[model samples]
Every structure is written in structure tokens, then in C-alpha cells.
Target chain A: DTAVSQTPKYLVTQMGNDKSIKCEQNLGHDTMYWYKQDSKKFLKIMFSYNNKELIINETVPNRFSPKSPDKAHLNLHINSLELGDSAVYFCASSQDRGRMKQYFGPGTRLTVT
Target chain B: AQTVTQSQPEMSVQEAETVTLSCTYDTSENNYYLFWYKQPPSRQMILVIRQEAYKQQNATENRFSVNFQKAAKSFSLKISDSQLGDTAMYFCAFMKREQGAQKLVFGQGTRLTINP
Candidate 1:
């Protein structure tokens, strides 16, 4: 069983188009996060959502929004995607906010032309 | 802000040999966690090993072990009898112990190559 799974393993889209990435965790986690790895392989947190609130990094642009339909799912939607948006996005989940061990899903490689 | 640094941008090891990857972090918080994650060509982020801040003893999992120096704020990973499948991008990460501090501060990553 896949503990964490993400859809659209690879995505290609135009610069101005909007795109979305879907993530689901069957591990019954209470916290989910989104991280981006640039071409340099520098990974940084974009957003984190728990059962109650969504915590976002100020560095992330407003075009990106994270929606957690439930504790097990966290979807990211990017508006007016730019060339800079071309990177690998990873979804991760932890048993809870207190649990430090996180399980990551196979990343989604998004390429914006 | 907490930051994880992997000074070595790349490393190589021969099959059946051992190699060490160094990592250092800067943080003001005393309670936190350190982790080593491996991402293979398939691009799946796999947790290789983990170390708790308060634990003075290093953590080891079979062939993977960590040298965690809490005072020095250094955590290094040692791989024994490296295999070709060990070739991947290894990232060091830090997480605060506080509840909901789930965001991981990751290093740029060090590309490890296991030669046959």
C-alpha cells in the first residue's frame, strides 16, 4: 500500500495556464505539506495544512493556494504559472503535527514552457 | 530561521565500500529533529534515517547510521557497503519539535554516486 501518493507524476503546461497537483495519504496522517525542489535541488516548504489550519510560507507567491478537503488530502493549485514554476513538487504527510517522521510521495515534475 | 547545510555537493563510493556524508545545521531552538532523505532516479523521497536532538547516542538502521553531535549541531550519515542502488540525491533536513512545526528545512542536497 502506498502511504503517500500524488497524481500527474509529470506535468507540462503553458506559462499562462493554471495547473493543479493532487495528493493523498492513506497513512491516516493529520498533517500534510507541499515542498518544491528547484533545478538546483534546493527544496523548500511551500505550504502545510493540518486538520485545523493552513500554514503558508511568506516567500510563496499569492498565485499558489493549498486546499485540504480533509486530513488525508491536500491539493495545490497554481494560477498564471510561470517559467519559474517548472520544478518538482513533493507531497508529504506525518501521523500528526507532533510526529517528526514524515512520509513523502513520489514527486510531480511540472514543466512550464 | 533554521537552516540545514550539506557542504559536499557530490560524493562517490565504490560497491562494497563505505562513505560518509556530512551535514551541519544552524538553529536557535534546542528541541528539533534531523533527517536524511534519499531521492533516487524514480524521484521518490525516502527517509533514510532520523536522529532526535536530545539523544546523545547516534541512531543506526542496518547499513545506514548517523553521527549526531547535538552540541556541535552536526549530523552526518554513514553508509556501509554501498551498492549501486544507493546512488541518489541525499538531502539533510531539520524540523522543530513544536506541534504543527511540520515544515522541514532541507539542504540543497548532495548527489551520491555508487560505482560498480
Candidate 2:
């Protein structure tokens, strides 16, 4: 069984279009995170949710919003996507808040044209 | 802010050989954790090993082991009897043991190619 999973492994959208990526974790972890890997392969944390509550919000644009319906699911919605949004999005989950190892899902490759 | 650096961007070694990937970080906090993650062509992040700052002994997982030097703020990963399946982009990461939502600070990454 896959501990972490993301839908639409590959997404190709046009500029100014809105898109949403869904992530679900079956590990029963309390914390979930969204990370963006740019073309240079630089990974940065965008948002984090612990027990369905927002815990960390990085210096991301307002166009991006993360919603957690429950402890097992965290979804990312991008509004008015731009060319710069082209990158790989990874969903991760951990058992606790700190010092715990994070399990990552197969990343979703997003390409905005 | 904590930063992790992997100076060697890429490395190659023949099968049955051994290789070491170096990583260093800068942080004021004494309590923290370090990790090594591997991403192959499939683009799946897989945890290779982990080390705790409080633990003096290095961490080992089968063929993968970490040499953790807290004093120098360095953590290096060594792969023994390297195999082609081990070829991947290896990343060194850090996490502080604090009271908030701890996030991982990853290094630039090292692409290791295990030749047959």
C-alpha cells in the first residue's frame, strides 16, 4: 500500500488557468506538507498542516492556497497559474510535528504554458 | 535560518565500489536532526538514513550509513558495495528540534551514478 499518494501525476495547463492538486496520506500522520521543486531542483516548503490546522505558511504568493479537509488529506489550489509555476509538487506526511521523518509521495509534475 | 550544502553536484562510481557524498550545514541550534533522501528517475523521494544530533554514534541502514559530525556541522553519506539501483539524486536535509512546525531544509543535492 502506498503511504502517500497524489492525483494527476502530470498536469499541463495554460497560463491564467486555475488548477488543483490533491494529496492523501494513509499513514495516519498528524502533519502534512507541500513542497515545490523548481527547474533547478531546489525544494522549498510552501505550507504545512497539523491535524487539519494551518501551522506553517511560507513566503508564497497569494495565488496559491492549501486546504486540509482532514488529517489525512491536504490539497493545493493554484489560481491564475503562471509560467513560473512550472515545477514538481510533492506531498509529504509525518507522524508528529518535529524531528520525525517525513514520507513523500510520487511528485506531480506541473507545467504551465 | 539553517542551510544545507552538498558541494559535489555529481559523482560516478563503478559497481561493487564505495562512494561518499559530503554535506554540511550552518545552524545555531544544538538540537536537530539530519537525513538523506534519494530520488531516482522515477522522481520518488525515498529516505535513505537519519541521524540525531544528540546521538554520538553514526546511523547505518544496511549498505547506507551516515557519518554525523555535530561539532563540524557535517553529515556525509557513504554507500558500500554500490549498485546500479543506487543511482539517484541524493539530498541532505536538516530539521531543528523545536516547539513549532519543523520543516526540512534540504541541500542542493548530489547526483550519484553507479556504473555497471
Candidate 3:
């Protein structure tokens, strides 16, 4: 069983379009995070949710928003997608905030044309 | 803002040989955690090893080990008898001990290629 799972491992869309990535964790973790890895392979944290509450918000654009329906799921919605937004997005979860190890999901390769 | 730095962009080693990946971090927080993560071609991040700042003893897991120099703030991963499966992008991360908001600050990552 996958501890953390993300849908649509690959996504291709035109610029200015909107898209969303869904993530779920079966490990019963209280903290979940979203990270973006660019073409250069630079992985950076974009957002984090703890117990269904938004906690860490990196210097990402306002067009990107993270919604947590419950503690087990966190979804990312990107509006007005840009060419620069084409990158691999990864979803991760940790048992408790910061002190515990994080489990990551297979990344979603998003391509914006 | 804490930062992790992996100076080597890429590294290579022959199978059954040994290789060391260097990492350094900058953080004012005295209490923190360091980690080494491996990302294979599948793009799945795997935890290779972890070290706590408070513990002076190095952490070792089978073929994987770490050299943690707290005074120098340098944490490096040493892979003995590297295997082809060890070939991947390795990242060093730092986590603060604070509760409720622990985010990992990652390095640029080192691409390790093991030649069989």
C-alpha cells in the first residue's frame, strides 16, 4: 500500500489554463506538504498543512493555493498556469510537525505549453 | 532562514567502490535535524539516513553512513561498496526542532552515478 499517493503522474496543459493536483496519505500523518521541482531539479517547498490548517506558506505566487479537506488529504490548485510553472510537483507527509520523518509520493510531472 | 548546500552538482563511482557526498547547512538554531534523501529515476524521494544534532554518534544504516561534524555544521553521507541501485539524486535537508511547523530546507542535490 502506498503511504502517500498523488493522482495524474503526468499532466500537460496550455498556458493560462487551470489545473489541480490531488494528494492523499494513508499513514495518518498530521502534516502534509507540497513541493515544486524545476527543470534544473531544484526542489523547494511551496505550502504545508497541519491538522487541516495552513501552516507553512513559502514565497510562492498567489496563483497557487492549497486546500485540505481533512488531515489525510491536501490538494494544490494552480490558476493561470504559466510556462515557468511546468515542473515536477511532489506531495509529502510527516507524522508530526517538523520532528518526524517525511514520506513522499511519486511526483506529478506538469507540463505547461 | 536556514539553508542547505550540496557543493557537488554531480558525482560518479564504480560499483563496489566507495563514494562520499558532501553537505553543509547554515542555521542559527542549535537544535535541529539533518537528513539524506535519495531520488531515483522514478522521482520518488526515499529517506537514506538521518542524524540528530544533539547526538554526537554518527548514524549508520547497512551500507549507508553519515559523518556529522556538529561544530563545523557539516553533514556528509558516505556510501561504502556503492551499488548501481545507489545511483540517484541525493539531497541534504535541515529541519528545525520547533513544533507545529517543521519544514525541511533542502540542498540543490547531488546526482550520483554508479558505474557497473
Candidate 4:
């Protein structure tokens, strides 16, 4: 069984469109995170949630928002997506808040045209 | 702020040979954790190994081992008996022991190719 899973492995959308990427973890982890891997393959954290509460918010634009309905699900919503938003989005989860090992899901490739 | 650096952008090794991927980090806090992650063409990030700062002994996982130098602030990954399956983009990461919230800082990454 997949510990962490993301829907729509590949997403292709036009600029100014709104899109949502869903992530779910079966590991019963309390912490979940969203990371963006740009064209240069530099992975950066965009947001993090702990037990359905927002914990960490990077310097991401206001157009992007993350919602966690429960400890097992974290979803990312991007509004008015721009060309620069084209990149791979990764979802990860860990058991604790400290520096613990994380389990990542198969990334979602989002191409904004 | 913590930073992880993988000096080698790319590396290649013949099958059955051993290869080492170097990684160095900078941090003010004395307590933290280090990790080595591998991402193949499938773009799935997999944890190769992890090392805790308080532990003096190095960490080893099967064919993978890490040389953790706390004073030098270096953590390098060594792969023995390299196989083609080992070819992937290796990332070195750091995690601070912060309360409530914790995040990983990843290096630029090193692409290792294992040729048979």
C-alpha cells in the first residue's frame, strides 16, 4: 500500500486558471507538507500543516493556499496560476514535529501554460 | 538559517565499484538531524539514510553508509558495490530540532550515474 499518494500525477492548465492538487497519507502522520520543485530541480517548502492546523508558511504568494481537512489529508489550491507556477509539487508527511524522517508521495507535475 | 550543499553536481561510477557523494552543511544550532534522499527518473523521493547529531557513531544502511563529521559540519554518503539501480539524483538534507514545526532544507542535489 502507498503510504502517501497525490492525485493527478500530471496536470496541464492555462494561465490564470484555478487548480487543486490533493494529497493523502495513510501513515497516520500528524504533520504534512507541500514542496515545490522548480525547473532547476530546487525543492522548496511552500507550506506545512500539523493536525489540520497551519504551522509553516513560506514566502509563497497569496494565490496559493493549503487546506488540511484532517491529519491524513492536505490539499493545495492555486488561483490565477502563473507561468512561474509550472513545476513539480511534492507532498510529504512525518510522524512528529521534530527533525524526523519524512515519507514523500509521487510528485504531481504541474505545467502552467 | 541552515544550508546543505552537495558540491558535486554530477558523478559516475562503474557497476560493482564504490562511490562517495559529498555533502556539507552549515548551522548555528548544535542539535539537529541529517538525511540523504534519492530521486530517480520516476521523481519519487526516497530516504536513503539518516543521522542524528548527538550520535557519534556513523549511520549505515545495507550498501549505504554516512560519514558524519560534526566539527567539520560535513555528512557524506558512501555507496558500496554500486548497481545501476543506484543511479539517481541524490539530495542531502538538514532538519532543525525546532518545536511545534520542523522543515527540511535540501541541497541542490548530485546526479549519480552507475554504468554497468
Candidate 5:
């Protein structure tokens, strides 16, 4: 079983369109995160949720939003996608007090045309 | 804001040889966590190793090990007897020891290739 899994591993959409990526973790983790990896392979944290509460929201654009229906699931919705948004999006999770390990999913490769 | 830096953009090692990937980070928090993640061609982020700031003893897992210099703010990964399976993109990540969710600050990553 996959510890963390994301749907739509590779997504392609036109610019200005809306898309969403869903994530789930079977590791009984309470904290989940969304990260973006740019073309240069630079990874940056976009959002973090702990037990369905928003914890960390970096200086990301307003078009990006994260929803956590429960502690086990976190979904990302993007509005008015742009070419600059084309990158690999990753979902990660860790236990409530897990300070050393964060399990990650096979990232979603989003393409904005 | 804490930042992780992986100076080596790429590295290559022959099979059964050894390779070292360097990483450095800057953070204001005294107690934190450092990690090495491996991303293979399948594009999955796999935890290779982890080190806590409070622990002076280095962490080792089979063929993977880490040299954590807390005072120097440097954490490097050493792979002994590198195998073809070890070829992947290695990332250095840092997370604060806060009470809630941990936001991982990741480095640019180092691409490692193991030759046969």
C-alpha cells in the first residue's frame, strides 16, 4: 500500500482553466503539506494543514487553495491557472509529533498550456 | 526563513564505489530536523535518512549514512558501495520543531548517477 498517494499523476490543462489535485495518506498522519517543484527543480512549500486546520501558508498566489476534508486527505484547487504554474506538485504527510520523517507521494506533474 | 542548500548539482559514482552529497542549511531555530530524500526516475519522494539536531550521534541506515555537523550547519549524506538503484535526485530538507505541522524547506537537489 502507498503511504501517500496523489491522483492525476500528470495533468494537462489550458491556461486560465481550473484544476485540482487530491491527496491521501494511509499512514495515520495528522499533518499534510503541499509543495511545488519548479522547472529548475527548486522545491518550495506552498501550504500545510494540521488536523484540518491551516497552519502554514507561504507567500503563494491566491489562485492556490488547500482543503482538508479530514486529517487523512488534503486536496489542492487552483483557479485561473497560468503557465508559470506548470510544475510538479507534491503531497506529504507526517505524524502529529513526527519531527524527523515526512512521507511523500509521487508528485503530480501539472502542465499549463 | 530557514533555507537548505545543496551545493553539488550532480554527482556520479561507479557501482560498488562510494559517493558523498553535501548540504548546508541556515536556520534561526536551534532545535530542528534535517533529512535526505531520494527521488528516483519514478518521481517518488523516498526518505533516505534523517537526523535530529539534539542528537549528536550520527544516523546510519544500512548503506546510507549522514554526517551532521550541527555547529557548522552542515548535513551531508554518504552512500557506501553505491548501487545503480541509488541513482536519483537527492534533496536536503529542514523542518522546524514547532508544535504543529512542519513546513519542509528543501534544497535545489543533487542528481546522482551510479555507473556500472
Candidate 6:
């Protein structure tokens, strides 16, 4: 069984289009996170949710929104996608502890044409 | 704000050799955590090792280990008897010990190549 998984491993769309990436974790974790890796392979935190409550929000654009329906699910929705949004988005989950290790899902690579 | 820096953008070594990837971080907090994640061509992020700042002992897992210098704010990953499977992009991450959820600040990553 997969501990963490993401849907639409690869997404290709034109600019001004809206898209969403879904993530789920079977590890029964209370905290979830979203990270983006740009073309330069630089990884940065975008958002974090704990027990379905918003916790950490980085300096990401307002076009990017994260919704956590439950503790096990965290989804990213992008409105008016741009060419610069082409990158890999990773979903991770961990226990509600600062020192706990986070389990990462297979990233979703989004390409904007 | 916390920042992680990986000086070497890329590195290569022969099989059975050893390689060390350097990483340094800047943070005002005394207690934090350091982690090493490996991403191969498949683009799966795998946790290789972790180190807690409060502990003085280094962390070791199988062939992977980390040298953490708290005073100097340095964390380096050393792979012994490197194998072909060790080829991947290694990222150094930092997280502060806080009350609630923690966010990881990752470095630019270092691409490691193991040649046979």
C-alpha cells in the first residue's frame, strides 16, 4: 500500500487555465504540507495544514490555493496558471510534531504552455 | 528567516568510493532539525537521514551518515562505499522545533553521480 499518493502525475495546459492536484496519505497523519520545486530544482514550502486547519502559508501567489477536506487529504488548486508555474509540486504528511519525519508523495509535474 | 545552502551544485564519484556533500544553514533558533532527502530520475522524494540539533551524536543509517556541527551551523552528508543506486539529487533541509506544524526549508540540492 502506498503511504502517500498524488493524482495526475503529469499535467499539461495552456496559460490562463485553472488546474488542481489532489493528494492523499494512508499513514494516518495529522499534518500535511505542499512544496514546489522549480526548474532549478530549488524546493520551497508553499503551504501546510494541520488537522484540516491552515497553519503555514508562504509567500506564494494568491492564485494558488490549498484545501484540506480532511486530515488525510490536501489539494492544490491554481487559478490562471502561468508559464512560470511549470514545476513539480510535492505533497507530504507527518505527525503533529516538529521533529517528526515527513512522508512525501510522488510529485505532480505541471507544465503550462 | 531560515535559509539552507548547498554549496556544491553537482558531484560525481566512482562506485565503492566515498563522497561527502556539504550544507550550511542560518537560523537564530537554537533547537531545530536537519534532514537529507534523495530524489532520483523517478522524482520521488525519499528521506535518507535526519539529525536533531539538540543531540550531539551524529545520525547514521546503513551507508549514509551526517556530520552536524551545531556551533558552526553545518550539516554534511557522507556516503560510504557508494554504489550505483546512490546516484540522485541530494537535498539538505532545515526545520525549526516549534509548537505546531513544521515547514522544511530546503537547499538548492546537489546532484550526485555514481559511475561504475
lDDT of all predictions, in order shown? 0.89, 0.93, 0.93, 0.93, 0.92, 0.94
Per-residue CA lDDT of model 5 for A1-113, tens digit only, reads: 98999998999999999999999999999899999999998889899998899988889999999999999999999999999999999999988663557888999999999
Q: Between 3 and 5, whose lDDT is larger?
A: 3
Per-residue C-alpha lDDT of model 3 across residues B1-116, encoded as one tens digit per residue: 89899999999989999999999999888888999999999889999999989999999999999999998999999999999999999999998743475689999999999998
Tell me each candidate's TM-score.
0.96, 0.97, 0.97, 0.97, 0.96, 0.98
TM-score of chain A of each: 0.94, 0.97, 0.96, 0.97, 0.97, 0.97
Q: Which stretches of candidate 3 lie over 4 Å from their true place?
A: A97-99, B97-99
- For residue A24, model 1's alpha carbon misses the true position, in angstroms, by 1.0
Residue B96 lDDT in model 4? 71
| Candidate 4 structure quality by residue, lDDT tens digits, B29-105 | 88789999999999999999999999999999999999999999999999999999999999999987444556899
Model 1, span B47-94: residue lDDT tens? 999888988889999999998988899999999999999999999999
What tens-digit string does per-residue lDDT give for candidate 6 at B1-116? Answer: 99999999999999999999999999999878899999999999999999999999999999999999999999999999999999999999998744468779999999999999
lDDT per residue, candidate 2, B21-65, as tens digits? 999999998888999999999999999998989999999999999
| lDDT accuracy of residue A48 in candidate 3 | 90
Task: Name the regions of candidate 6 deviating beyond 4 angstroms.
Answer: none
Model 6 lDDT on a 0 to 1 scale: 0.94
For all the predictions, what are the DockQ values? 0.72, 0.64, 0.71, 0.70, 0.81, 0.80
Work out the iRMS of candidate 1.
1.5
Better candidate number, 2 or 5, judged by lDDT: 2
Give the distance in Å from residue B10's predicted Cα in candidate 1 to where it truly belongs.
0.8
Model 4's CAPRI class is: medium
How close to the true structure is residue A9 of candidate 1, measured as C-alpha lDDT?
95
